[model samples]
Each structure stands twice: as structure tokens, then as C-alpha cells.
Target chain A: MAGYLNLLLRLTIWFLLTADLSWDNLLLGVTIAVLLPRGATNPGTLKDWLYTLGEVVAAIPQAYKEAFEIMIYPHHHEAITLERAKPRRTPSLLFLDIFLITFTPKTIVQHYCEQGWYEVHRIQRRPTP
Target chain B: MINILSDGCMIIGLVFWFWGTWPLLGQRSVLYKLHSLSVADTLGSMAIVMGLLLRIPHEWPLLLLALISLAIWNTVLGYVLAYCSTREIGHDG
Candidate 1:
């Protein structure tokens, strides 16, 4: 399917670029490709393809700035006292939001199944609504 | 000579890819194709950068920026792809 092919391509690209196709990297890439939102409306038209391309292109600078910020300052934020609060809402922009946060240092993607929520764990928590 | 060789090698990689890889895989899947092309773009530019770095040893700052930029880009792409894929496939359905 389109999804599988994309996974293969992403893996091949990473292998080609880094000159480090160790088993570890290959396994990691395979794991990621398999984990990607598959069948979530595969890009079927020229427009879809263009949109995906633009998304990737847009990720570069946003990621860079995040990296810069994390590097200059590494501190933790407050924690979520209550799990059900909308303040703990998952990112609305989905991939872009996920990319920005993970790209920033000291933050990780933690999946909480008790509430079935995916939250960003920052160094420090921010005031929530 | 180095720049020429670098360009030539990249071209060769492209050729090998189009001729050898594409036909074998069948390029109908847009996600797959884009993923592969992302790899190509990342590697293709990386090679050119590396070649330039080798040729110009004095521009350390520029080289450092290039390396950092690429690293950040790659990491972000990986994270986005993983998170989006997970949420889309796992919880959405």
C-alpha cells in the first residue's frame, strides 16, 4: 500500500543520508515507519502530495528554533495535577504540534493509557485553561 | 575536481535510484514515494554539504550550521512522522 511504500522510502532515505545503516538504525526506522499513522487518509491527489511536501518543508525551521530554545534554557515546567482537564488536551495540529514539542529538548511523548491521552512532558508545566 | 566528483556521485545515486529502485518497488504509493524522496533529498543535500565541507576547510562556522540544521530537520521529521502515524492509526479509528 501507499503507507508501506512511504515507510520503506523514509527508511531508505535515512540510511542513505547518515552513512550509518547499523542494525540499530534500521530497526529504529522500521519501528517508526510501522508506528506512523497508517491509512489515515493517504495522500491520493497532487494536492495531498503537495500538502505533505509543504509540511515536511515547514518542519525544518520550526524544529531549528525549538532546538535553539531548548539548548539555551533547560528547565522543567509544572505537572498536570488532574488528568481529565482539557488543559491536558492532545495537540490540535497533530503532527506539526508533535514535531515541535519533541524537537524541543527536555520534552518527551508520554502516552497515558489510564485516560487514553498523549501529553507532552516539558521540563516545567505551563499554566493551563 | 572535488565539487564535480561530488555532484557526479549524487547524480549517480539518483540514477541508480530511479532506474534500479523505483521500478522494483512501483511508485504508486504517494506516502512511500514521498518518504523515499525525503531520504533522497536529505542524502543528496548532505552529500553536497559534505563535499563542500571537504573542499573548504576554513568555513567551519558554516559547516557547523549546516550540520546542526540537518540534524534538527531529520530529528523533527522522524518525531512528526511517528507521532502523527500513531495518533492517526491508533486512537483515531
Candidate 2:
């Protein structure tokens, strides 16, 4: 499953680079995509993949909102907070979680501890009237 | 109509860039500055790239790829920098 996903991702990059849809180009792309060695086996289910993708899509609007809110100059509170992670969370999920949090302007994940805690730096901005 | 939308995108992106960059001169911490930079550099660049895509639909493949790269790389780079810097600072030290 992950192999097919990796293939699709590689193919997208190939198509974007070549920017052509000729039959020969398509054949060549498919050949290259298939022939390329896969990365280290990453444990992920299709369901998990779709869920992560959905979460990412949802975070886009939230990120924009946070970006605008952070621009507001007001009395904001900054703090270092510890967020607990799921003990069994996989590396890919951890990556996505860190990305999503940091992508928003309000919070950043500074480090992930072996104890399953995320040290987060967060800015709490008050809404202006 | 399309022209207006493309122009609007460019303008919005410019606004983001300005606002995001404006905070660097203040007394904000390094993390806060990084957050702002990501918003400006990543999201703002994506918006500008999209505006260009609307303007030059023929070169969409390249622009789209650039948009994706900007978004992902900027986000990751910001995280990595923050993670590394804060680590060396000894957390709350």
C-alpha cells in the first residue's frame, strides 16, 4: 500500500518536472516510478494515511486564521507547554503532528521526548474588539 | 474577473509578507519570529505562486510544483530550526 502511494508521489513529481503527457513520456515515467527503490518501510495503514491527509487539509484554513490572528498586536501570552503524545504513535504520524502544530503561527513543537511529551512553545493572543 | 482574482491574490500575498516581516524588528523571541517568517515565507509565497499560476496558466506544472515545495520545505525548515536552537539552549535554561 505504501509502495503504491510512494509510486504515485514519485510519478507526480516526474510529471510535474517533464510537464508533458505524451504516451512515451507516460511510459517512461511509469517505468521510472516502478523501478526506483522504495524508501525504508514506513508502517502506515491506508486508513491512517487518509486520516492524516484529511487532518492536513483541515489544518490549512486553521493555519491561515492563526497567521492573521498572530499579526494582531496586543497583549499576548507566551509559554512553554508540555503536550503528551500517544505513546505508540508512529514516526510518520509524529512528523505530521509536529508539522501541523508548527505550521500554525500560534504553536511550535520544540522537541519530542522519549517520554512521549512534546515541548511546545505557544503564543496565546487575545482577540481584539 | 480572472484578472481581478489574480491581482487580489498577489495583493493578499504581499500583505502577508509585509505583516509577517514587520515583527522581526520588535522584541519578540526567536520562536515567535520564526512563526511569523513561516507564515510570510511559506504561505505568502504559496499565495504568490498561485497568483502567478492564474496569470500564466500555461506554466502551471512548474508553478504548482514550486508552490508545494515552498509550503512543505518552509514548514519543515522552520520546525527543524526551532527544534535545534531550543535544544541547544537547554530547554528552559
Candidate 3:
């Protein structure tokens, strides 16, 4: 039930973004939304999706702050290796994680290894320690 | 009042766009330059779009699409460019 609803919502947003209420465009949006790969069998409830959206919105200020810091100071490049420990890594969750992390100017995912590790490149001022 | 806010956003966006370029001329690695460029470009573009959105509220649908595209495609492009550079280096060595 939730999956279908989610699909409908996405389709609606797609239509709005296109600003075309024509039948053909509406059908196309529905087709594309249906054809796209969904995350998991049971993605999540609407509340969960709303929570995630809120988190993303809250992070915007932090992203802007980091961008300003990088611009103002000399930053050194470093790669932070990370391992994904989650047993069930949903595609949607992974995509969201990558998008949020990269949205910030301070860090970007450089590589994702098949061996379950991610090479994230970050820029920061040299530590005083 | 709205005009003032929109102009402020546009000016800040332009500043960010120009700020990103300064690293290119410095003694930084390709990755560093790419990092600065992508970050500034994304934020600056988004800011400019926001300004436009405020100025022309009626055309928000297109502007919103532009913002989404900037967020998604810019990050993907950065990853692709970095990956290609690494592959090229591996080939040479």
C-alpha cells in the first residue's frame, strides 16, 4: 500500500516539476515512475519518508557553513575510508546517503568498492594536533 | 523588499562562483581543484536559481527542476571525473 502511494506521490511531483498537465506527459510520468527500480519490497511508511526529508532540509545550513569554510581557508585533501555495516542496505537509503553527503561541499564520495567500503574525499583545514 | 533579497542572493551566488576558481590557479592537486569547483558551482548555481525563483514566482516549476538537476547531476559528474582521472593515471603507470 505504501509503495503504491509513494509511487503516486513521486509521479505527482514529477508532473508538477514539468508544469505540464497534458494527458501524454502525465502518462509518461506515471510510466517512468512505475518502471524505475524501487528500493526494497517494503520501503517505508510516509512518516519515515517525511522524517528523512526533514533531515535533509536541516542539513542545508551545515552544508552552507562547510562550503564557506572551505572557501575561506586552505584545505588539505584526505580520504576517509568507511565500511557499511547495515545488514539490509536499501537502494533508496544508499542513494539518499550519497546525495546528502555529496551535497555538502566538505565531502564527496570518490569511490565505492565492491568489498563494502567507500572512499570518501574530504577537504578541511589542517588539524592543530 | 523582495527585490533587495533576490539581488543579495544573486550577488552572493556570483561571489561563490568566482571564489571556486581561485583554487584552480593555486598549487593544488587535480582532485582538490575538482572539489572546489564542483562545490562552488553547485551552491552558486542553486543560489542563482533561488534568486530567479523569488523574482519570477510563476515559473517556479522550471526553476525547481533546475535546482534538482544541479544537485543530482553535479555530484554524479564529480564522481565520474574523479574516477576517469584515477583510471588514466593507472593506465600510464
Top lDDT hit: 2
Q: Give all candidates' CA lDDT scores.
A: 0.48, 0.83, 0.75
Worst 10 residues of 2 chain A by lDDT: A120-129
**In TM-score terms, which candidate is top?**
2
CAPRI verdict (incorrect, acceptable, medium, high) for model 1? incorrect
- Candidate 3's displacement at residue B86, Å, is 3.0
What is model 1's DockQ versus the real complex?
A: 0.06
- Residues B8-65, candidate 2: write the lDDT tens digits: 9898889999988988999988887887787789878878888889999999899989
TM-score of chain A of each: 0.39, 0.83, 0.65
- Please tell me which model should have the higher lDDT, number 1 or number 3: 3
TM-score of chain B alone in model 1: 0.56
As a whole number from 0 to 100, the lDDT of residue B55 in candidate 2 is: 93
Model 3 spans > 4 angstroms off: A20-51, A77-79, A83-85, A127-129, B87-93
Give the alpha carbon lDDT tens digit for every residue of A1-129 in model 1.
345446766676555555465799788878876777754643344444455447756755554344335334532243322233223322223443444444433343433344534564434324444
All models, RMSD in angstroms = 17.4, 2.8, 3.5
lDDT tens digits, residue span A3-109, model 3: 87668768867976889989999889989999888766657556655665677787678777888887777687455556462344445656666667677877777
Ranking by DockQ: 2, 3, 1
lDDT of 1 by residue, B5-84 (tens): 75675664464345323523674332233333333444435545666676676665566467556645854664555446
Q: What is the lDDT of residue A86 in candidate 3?
A: 38
